[model samples]
Target chain A: MSEFLVLVVPMWVVFTLAAQGTILSGRTGVFNVTQEGVMALGASVGFLVSYKMGSNLVGLLIAFLVGALVGLVLAYMTTQLRLDQFVVGLALFFATTGAAGLLYRQVIGVTMTPPRVDTLPKFEIPLLGDLPLIGDALFVQDYVFYFAVILSLVMFWFLQHTSAGLDFRSVGENPKAADSLGINVTWARTWSTVVGTGLVAVGGAYIPLPFTGIYTDGMIAGRGWLVIALAFLGGWRPLYVVAGAAFFAAMDVLGQKAQVLGLGIPHQFIEMLPFVATLLVMVFALRWARQPAHLGMNYDRESRLVG
Target chain B: MSTMQKSETGPGGSPPVAKPEARGPGILTNIAWTVVPYVASVVLAFFLGGLLIQLMGYNAVDALRAVLTSSFDTSFGMVETLHKWVPIVLCAYAFAIPLATGKFNIGAEGQMLLGATGGAAVGITFSDLPMVVLLPATLVAGVLAGALWAGIAALLLVRFRVNEILSTVLLNFVSFKLIDWVATRVWPDAGAGHPATTPVGDGARLPLLGSAPAMHSGVLLVLALAIFIAVAMRFTPTGFEMRAVGDNLRASMVNGVRTSRLAGAGLVIGGGLGGLAGAIDVAGVHGRMLEGMQSNFLILGIIVGLMARGSMLALPVVAFGIAVLEYGAGTMQLVSAVPVEMVLVIEALILLLLLLSDLVRDRLRSAR
Candidate 1:
C-alpha cells in the first residue's frame, strides 16, 4: 500500500496541477486545449535548463515563465483579437509542439544516447516521515510534490473563499454583467490565462523532475489531455480534481504494477487503460458535469452581446 | 452566423432594400481582401522559415532556392506533390465535414490509422480474390473502420452528451495502442524485426498514373469526391440542413431540424473520408500498413481545414500550398542539412502570422 502511494502521489500532483490550471482558465471563459503542447514545451525546457543550471527550482521557474509567455499569446488571441478559442488554442498547440521539438533538437542534438539528469531528491520530514502507513507517501516527497499540494489548496481557497475569486467566477459566468459591475473582464481573463498556464507548466515540470528524469519527444504524452478530462470530471473544483487525479493516477500505477507482476496481458492494453478510462468517465459523467457557461466563447465588447 | 443573415432577410421572407452609397467594399477590394493577404502571409512564412534555417547555420537563400526549385521546378517534383496532395486533401475533408456541423473531430489521425489497419486486414485476408472484388472490399473495410472509430465519439455525444472533442482526442490514444496491438500480436509479420503486418495483396493495389514519380489513380477519386461534395452542399436539402445546424444549432433545433442526425452524418462522412485516405495510402503508395505513418496527418489536415474555413472549394488550394511547403521542407533538409522539424516550426509560424495579420486587417477595417 505504501509502495502504491509512492507511485501514485507525484502523478496525482502533476495531473491535479494541470487540472487546476485548466479550471482557472476555464473559470475566466477560455478553454485552453494548448495545455498538451504547452506542457510538452515545459517538459523539454525544464529538462534542458535543469541539466544546464544544475538547479531544479530555476528550471521549473523558467518552464512556468515560458508557459506564461505562451498563455499571453493565447490571451491576446482570444481576448484582444476575439478569435475562436478552440481554433486559436489548436494553432498554439501546433506551434508549441513544433517549437518544443525544434528547440530540443537544437539544444540537444540528435544522438544515439539521449541526455539525462538527476531527479529532484526527496525531502523527508522528521516525525512525519516516521509515520507507519502514510509517512513516505505523504510526508516525504520532493519539493514539487509538496508545492503542488499547497498550490492546489491555495487555489481552492483563492477560488472559493476570496472576494477576488467570486469576481473571477462572476466574470466567467457573465462577463457583460461582471464588466458592468467594474470587474475588468479582460484583466481577469488575461491574468487567469497567464498565471493559470504557469501552474500548468509546473505540472509539466513534474514530467522531467520526478517521472522521467529525462526529456523525450513524447514525454508530456497525453497527460495534458488527461488533465483536461480530470478538470471536467472534477466539475472544475480543485479538491475534487485532486481526487480525480488520485483515481486516474492510481489506475496508471495499477497498470505499471500489473506490468511489473508480469501479467500475461499485452503491455499495450495496460498502456491504453488511462486513456480508455478517461473516455469512459467523460462519456458517463459529462452530462452532469457543470461546465463554465462561456467556456470557449470569446468576450467581445463591441460585438452585440447575444445569448 | 445565421443571425446576421436572418436580420438581413427581414420579416416574412422580404429582403431588406439595398442602399447605393451605404454598400460595403467594392468587388475588387473584396477579392483583394480575400486573396492577397493570405498569399502574402504564405510568402512571409516561407521567408521566416528561411531565416530560421539561416539562424541554424545553413545558407538561407541557398536552402530556400533548393526547396522551391526541387519541389516545384520539375515534373517529378510536381508528381510527388500531387501524390502527397491526395491524402492531405482527403484528410482535410475528413476534418472539415464534421466541423461543418459545428462538431470538432480531431480523431482523423486515429480514424486513418484504423482505416489502414482494416484495409490491410481485408487485403491480406482476401488475397485470392480478383482485383475488382478485393479492391472495393478493402476500401469498404477501411471506410467502415474509420466510421466506427468516429462513431464511438458520435455515440458518446448524441447519447450521453459527452463533448466530442475530448472523446475524439482520447480515442486517438486508444487507436494508436490498438494499431500497435494489431501490428504486433494480431497480425505479426512472420519474423519481422519490428512490429508490422503482412503486405496487402496485389489485387488491392491502386493503379499508377504514370511511370515516373508513380502517382496513384486515387487522385481521380479525390477530384470526384470534392466535386460531389460541392454539388451536394450547394443543391441538397440535407446539405442545407447541415449548414443551418452549423450556423446556429439553437435556431436549427427550433426550426425542427434533427441536429443530432446532422452531427452524426457529418462526423461519419468525415471519418469515412479519413479512412479512405488511409486506404489509398496503403493500396496506392505503401502497399502495406505502416506504423507511425499517421504522424502529423491530423494536424496538417486540421490546418488545411482551418485555412479552408468551411469553403470546400478552398480546400484544394490550401492543401496544395501546404503540400508544397511540406515537400519542399524535406528537400530543403536533405540539401541544406537543416533539421526536418524546422518544417513544423515554419508551419506553425505561418499559421500564427496569418492569424495576426487577419486580426490586424479586421481591426483596421473596423477602425475605418
Candidate 2:
C-alpha cells in the first residue's frame, strides 16, 4: 500500500503540471487534449533513444525536449486552426494512441518481445534508507522520484508567483482584454502548452520506470483523463493538486488492501480504484474546484469584442 | 436571454453585418447540410491518408486498393462488417438522441459496459432457462441496466449542475471496474488460459435470418428502432420539447417545458438505447462478457454520432459505412504486412478532415 502512494506521488506531479498547463492556457484560450498523444510521442522518443544510446542522461533530456515539441503542435492546432477543443482532445487521443502503437509495433514486431532499458537507478541517502518507514518511501528512491517531488514544488513557485503566471491567468480570465493590453495570447498559450505537454510526458514516462519496468502499448491506461479530472479537483492549486493526487493514490492502495482484509471481491474491480476515485472527484470535488472563466473557448483576433 | 443575443459572439461591440440570406430551408438543403459534412469529412480524411502513404514511399493507389479490398474480401469479412455495425448503429443512435437535446452523454462507454454486464450476468446465470424466458430477460436487463447507469449522470446534472461530460466520463470508470469484477471474480470462463468470463448458454442467443451475411433478425430490430425513433423525433410532443430544450434552455424553460425532467428523460432513454446495443451484442453476437468489450464500440459510437448529426435514420447507414471500413481494413491486414493500427490512423484522418471541413463551412457561413 505504501509502495503505491510512493509510486503515485510523482504521477500526481506530472498530472499537476498538465492541469496547470490547462489553467495557464485557459487564459490564452487553448485547452489541448493532445496530452495523451504527446506523452506517448515523448515516451517513444525517450525510450528509443535511451535504449539505443544506452544513456539515461540522454534519455531524460530527450523526454523533456520531445514533450515540449508535442505541446507546440497541440498549441498550434487549437489556437491557430480554430478547431473545437473537445474534438482536438479526441483527435490527439487517437493520433497519439495509434501513432505510439504503430511505432512500437514497427520497431518491436509481433512477438511479445520486451524492449530493454537500464533505468536511471535510485540511491539511498547515506543514513536515510534505514529509517523506520519514511526513509524507504521517499529517501531511498530513483532519480525520477526525487525529480517528481522537486518538480511539484517548482511548478508551485512557477505558476503562483511568477510574472508569466500572471500573464497566463490574465489571458484565461479574458483573452480580448488580455489581447488589448498586448498580452501575446498566442505566444503565452503556446509556451505554457508546450511546458504543460512536456509535464504530461514526464508523468506518462514515470509509469514504465521501477514501478512497472518495460512499457506495454496501453501502458498509459487512461491516467491522462484522471489527471484532467485531478486538475479540476485541485482547482489548479499546486498544494491542493498534491493533496488530490495523494487522495487518488490512497484510494487505489485501499482497493488493493481490501483483499488483505478478506473482502473476497473481484480483484479486477479493486484495481479499478483510481478510475472510480477520479469520477468521484469530478462529481463531488468539482464544486469546490475553481475553473478559469475563459477555459476551452477559442479567441479570434480578427473579430474583437469589447465587453 | 433573447436580448442578450444582440451579438452572436457574446455581447460584442457591433451587431455584425447581418448576411445570413435565408438559405430557404429546403428538404434538400437541410439534408445536404447534414449529409454532406460526413461525406466531406471521410473524403478529407482519406486524402490525408494518401499524403501519409506517399510520405512512406508507398503508392497511394495500393493503399487505397488495400483499404477497399480488405473491407469486402470474403463472407467472413462481410460478417465482420455486420458484427461491428450492429453496435455502431445502435450506439450512434444512443449518443445522437441525447446530443440532439444538447446533453453530452460521453458516458456511453460506461453505460454500455454496465448494461452489457447486467445483460450478460442474467444470461449466464440462467444459462439453463428456455429461450422463451432467457431472450426477453437479456433484452430487459440490457435496457434497464443502461437506463439505470445513465440515471446517475442525469440525477447529478439536474440535482447539482454537475457537468455531464465530466460526470459521464467518470461513470465510465465505475462501469469499467464493475465489468472487470464480473469477468474476473464471479464468472471466469477459464476456457482459454486468458482471464475471460464464461460464454452464455446457446438458448439465450439472438438468431440470424435466412443467409443474410450475419444480418440476424437483430437488423430488423435495429431498423424498426431507428424508424420509430425518427418518427418520434419528428412528430412526438416529447421529442419537440426535447429539441426545444436542447436548442435553448432558457426559451424552453420560459415556454413551460420541463427542462431538467426532459433532460433526465433523454438521459434515461439514451442510456437504455445504449445498453440495448450491448444486450444485442451478447444475444446476437458474442455469447459472453469480456474485458474492454465496448471500448472500441464507444469510439465508433462517437464517430457515427458526429457523422449522422443527431438523425436516428442516418445512424445505421453511417454505422454500416464504418463497418465496411473495418471489414476492409481487417482483410487488408491479413494479406498485407501492414499493422492494423493503420485503421485507427484512417479513422483519425477521417475525423480530423470531417472536423476541419466543418470548420471551413462554419467560417463561410459566418463570413457571408
lDDT of 1 by residue, B1-368 (tens): 11211221111111112224645767567666656667787789988988778887889887777666776788888887877888888888888888878888888989999899989999999988999999999889999999989998888888888888888888888888888888887878866676678888899998887786777888888888889987787579998888778777789999999999789888888888898888888888778887787867898998888777577777877888778877887887778767677777777777777666665656666788
Segments of candidate 1 deviating more than 4 angstroms: A255-259, B1-26, B74-76, B366-368
DockQ of 2: 0.42
Error of 2 at A66 (Å): 4.5
Model 2 steric clash pairs: A27-A171, A27-A172, A122-A142, B41-B354, B70-B328, B71-B327, B71-B328
Model 1 clash pairs are none
Count of clashes in candidate 2? 7
Predicted candidate 2 versus true structure: per-residue lDDT over B12-92, tens digit per residue: 111112225645555566556545765777877788777776665556666667777665667766666777787887777
Worst 10 residues of 2 chain A by lDDT: A20-29
Name the weakest run of 10 consecutive residues (lDDT summed) in model 1 chain A.
Answer: A298-307
Candidate that would win on lDDT: 1
Error of 1 at B231 (Å): 2.1
Best by TM-score: 1
